[model samples]
Target: MTENSEANSPGWFDKPANINRLIVALVSACLVLLAVEAIFGKSFYDDHHPAHFPIEQMFGYQALIGFLAFVVVVFLGTILRTVIRRSEDYYDR
Candidate 1:
């Protein structure tokens, strides 16, 4: 790669500092959202249909559920990939 080509490249997130900034921003946003929920979740949301199960009312329950759901989906996707994957030159014939 020539200097001209490298200079022309527009890789905004290719730098480690940018990646770290993005990570920090995302984590900070998550923490802020959790704090908001902790402060007003019961008064704002639970008034409609209060959860009977004690575990459902715990802090971060929704986040836990969402994370677990994502993990389950990725796990299923890996299993599906194993079932559908083909040999590298499958279409060369």
Candidate 2:
């Protein structure tokens, strides 16, 4: 029957509840990492160096920098694609 076939389908993640649970788990993990870093993280660089700015001492600074860099790269890639993308037809000669 149609009901039996539907019940026997193997798509565990096809439900909205499963997707929500996955999102919650991932967010919870990120929060835990952030909390751990905030409580126990230490700078790896020398204190007297110019590179060791005060703002850099804050927790999650590296993550912020990485995320910003990723956004910049994606923006630049979008611009490059517009400049270098080929036409749909060039072999019609």
Top-TM-score structure, candidate number: 1
Candidate 1 Cα misplacement greater than 4 A, ranges: 1-9, 46-56, 88-93
Model 1, span 1-93: residue lDDT tens:
122232334785578786686678778877998999888866745567777788777888888998899999999999999999999998996
The lDDT, on a scale of 0 to 1, for candidate 2 is 0.72
What is candidate 1's CA lDDT for residue 24?
82
Candidate 2 accuracy as TM-score: 0.60
Task: State the lDDT of candidate 2 residue by residue for 2-93, as single tens digits.
Answer: 22233445775588786686678767877897887776657544467544478877778877887899999999999999998887785664
CA lDDT of each prediction against the hidden true structure: 0.77, 0.72
